[model samples]
Target: MINPALQPLSDYTFARLARMLDGIAPAAGKRPILLSVGEPQIQPPAFAAEAIAAGSHLWNKYPPPKGDAAFLGAVTDWLTTRYGLPAGMLDTERHVTSISGTREALYQLGFLAVPERKNGRQPVILMPNPLYHSYRGAAMLGRAEPVYMNATPENGFLPALDEVAPEILERTALCFLCTPTNPQGRVASLDYLKRAIELAREYDFMLAVDECYAEIYRGVPPAGGLQAAAALGGSLKNIVVLHSLSKRSSGPGLRSGFMAGDPELVGRYAEYIMFGSASTPLPIQHAATALWKDEAHVESNRAHYAENWRIATQVLGNKKGYHEAEAGFFVCMPADDAEALTKQIWREQAVKIVPVGLMAREDAEGVNPGDPYVRIALVYDAETTEEGLRRIAPYF
Candidate 1:
């Protein structure tokens, strides 16, 4: 028998999309263009393949859950350079652990942090309304109350920290904050991250920052949680950051990422994964190590995304409610009826985009903040992206 808590998670975002477009076929003679998913279509660096092949001999070796020394050192060096972290501020062995990807580590964090009760009540897990589904899944399965904090235009598409009630804060066990947030590409400011870290410390809850999109931005690089912690005195207590090679290196298939933060939490997470989760393969870790050490490919990838954004602006800039994203690869725009528009575009132009409403939960007043928006991923090559945008522009 399945746990009753799992019942509400029957339909994931993509599953619902599939069900909605089940019987409807795309326009014939025009090959379908999918802009609904955030998977990058760019080729990862050639070094990735070479590194993997060179390390293939070690594939049979049982992988350690905490990752090997070389991989950890590369990750630490990258983090230090990328975020301008102080030298020796991070003790790799105690502060970092490799996971198959950020998704797995992000989900597992709930189990590591959520307790049976907080402040004599059922523990609460705070997440943005239009959040990654994994956060909700983790909270529910961990027996915590999932509190949806609304992120809407009124709040700059970022959840307002002041709105959360003190009672809820007192009971909160885990809080997930995503910068360059999914669906809406809004980047949180350094001050905002610092405030969040302070809250987690004050309330004595775990702060999990999902920074998977940190490397994909337009102008200034987005501020990271670790940067905030460093500026606030260099202690990583009550905070953890998750990063992935999927968005940064355009290598989603590699399934490599790492979690870094408080030594105590990192130790606990390593123990949990050692016993319960699959360790990242040695071959993949070697490839990821090379990927992290090199930034030329990342720069090339960023340039491609920038060009795609330029194409998007030229194609759809004049449309009502069209706004260029601050960071990340998605173009989120307000629609009169998001679901109807999503289906209409798919049926009429063979252009697929995601309706943001499906990813968000209703607020306490029973309103979904994402009801009026649709999220289109700008993850295709320039030609395909331009074609997709041209097809989608006329409708808006």
Candidate 2:
């Protein structure tokens, strides 16, 4: 019943996994170890639970269409500290809006940003090819061309912005880049982000950087879009960065994140969300506000992930393509043949993994960007993850 704008959107990997195994049980009542989805199994912060309970008194009142003032201030303070921004870089009142998570904001960007024409051509949404499908879906639904750029190892796992043809830039309306990227776990450096922001300014498009995985890393905290924006200047002009409590606080159920950038875009996004947006519930918003303000739990969560990474390295060791992720909890390693390997692991080992082909798109360069790869999510509790590895280790 929805319009044609949404008719061609591709199914997400998890949905496909659901369909492929329909009418099937995982090894006679055993829910086969699932290392396919990135949902975190880390225990959520204690303060979040307390905040939610404490804020329950406000449930009778309708939540603000824009988030509560204190909530916005909390986000602003966190940003100021996290990125060391000049006070004006993010105005608590005008430059930030709360979304359930980056995923929803990323999806809604298509509705707000995509246009019929830019410089007299179909608008383009430039993205890393094997990307979060929302970028492409938003492009298609908004009636724009989707420009696929290679973000694989040969390009240092960052899209080659300079290599893009000028013609494409003329019509580009939006560009999405993720730091500590999904599946591959590649972290974009500060220099890379500065170049990207420069390109967005030069080409006249909005740069939407996804920094959800910024908190989980091997060494120091991952370089974020906010840091890039700050380094370029204290002003958040052409860029909006989205960060979440999902990975940082181990609370995906909270479905909360903040988008901070240009005041004009934030104002417009607030309007769009006034009708179409799913705002976080008041108690949940309070919980998120608390989570953002406190970093103690976040540090503990990061340590846990690091420990998990150690366990992962010890189990898988250094096989071909077993590169250490600079950030994030995923390992993108090649399978001899992705689908065949997934099928083999599912049937023979009773373990489920997603084939990379379903996660990426093919381009004119004849690259199935996800080909020969299987994405493993180190998202489970340590014991479950160990069980998953014990079952699928043979493939590696």
Candidate 3:
């Protein structure tokens, strides 16, 4: 029999988009511009490849599931410098582990944290509306109730933890928060993060902070979860911050990232990885260590996204539903009807974008928070991004 949890899920975002446009052909003679997926088109630095090659001989050796000392050392150093955490505050052996990617770790965290029940009721996994699909999938497959905290303009596009009812918080087993949130690009403030961490500790839930887009900001570097944990006290209790080279170093294909936090939770997660997931290959770990150590490539990568966002503002700034994104690499704009707009853009301009409704679920009141918008990834070179934005500007 099919798992009962599978009954609640619809097709994934991209797969649903493909089905929606199955019969429609792109406009004749116009080259298709795909802005639907968040894949970065920039190439990572040459040194990454060199590091991988240098460690090529280790390909036959099974990588340690918890991670090797050298790679974990690099992560610890990077975290300390990037977040200004005090030296030795992070115990690499207990506070960190190599993840194949944040997506994999995020999904596995559901299994690691969620139990069959909380307070004798079905557990709740809280996440923001218009969330990364992985969060929803994790909660659902783990057999917990997925609670969506709608992040709309009324709340500055950041979900307010204080607004959640006390009953809901008590049953929460895991909570996922995304900084520089996907689609909306809003960053959670330091105070907000601290409050969230405090709530998680008080309610005794695991707080999973997705900071994968932490390095793609335009004006100032966004504050991070680890920073908040340090500011509150020296403890990493009840919080784990996830980082990835995907957006930071423009190396999604490398599939390298790590999660760091509470010693007990992290240790369990590391052990869980030993049985539940594949270890990151030694060569990839070597490349990732190099990528994490160097800020030059990340700076350059941010420049490309900055340029692309600038072009978006210059082209679509005056449009009715357009606003400058605070961070992250998407232009999520409002539309009268997102699905229709998506199809029209493909048919008329040969451009592809995602209807925001497809990425989010309806609330208890039956209103889908993403119904009024569409998400376009500005994850391309400035010129191509401009072309795509210009083509879809009229719809907004």
Which one wins on lDDT?
A: 1
Candidate 2 C-alpha lDDT tens digits along 241-353: 98888888888888888898878788888888778766788999999888888888888888888887887887887678887788989878887788777777777666777
Residues 1-396 of candidate 3 have per-residue lDDT tens digits of 877777545657887899989999999999999999999998999999999999999999999987788899999999999889988889999899888889988988788889889999999999999888889888876788999999899998899889999999999999999998988999999999999999999999999999999998888888989899999987899999999898899888998999999888788877887776788899999999888889998889888988898899899999887887888898888888889989999999999999999888899999899999999999888889999889888777
Off by over 4 Å in 2: 21-25, 28-31
Q: lDDT for model 1, please.
A: 0.91
Give the Cα error of residue 279 in candidate 3, in Å: 1.0
Clashes of each: 0, 1, 0
- Where does candidate 1 stray beyond 4 Å? none
Winning candidate number (TM-score)? 1
* CA RMSD, predictions in order: 0.9, 1.7, 1.1
TM-score of 2: 0.95
Q: Model 1: per-residue lDDT, tens digit, 230-271?
A: 999999999999998999999999999999998998899878
In order, candidate lDDTs are 0.91, 0.82, 0.90
TM-score of each: 0.99, 0.95, 0.98
Residue 277 lDDT, candidate 1, scale 0-100: 85
Residue ranges of candidate 3 with Cα displaced over 4 Å: 8-10
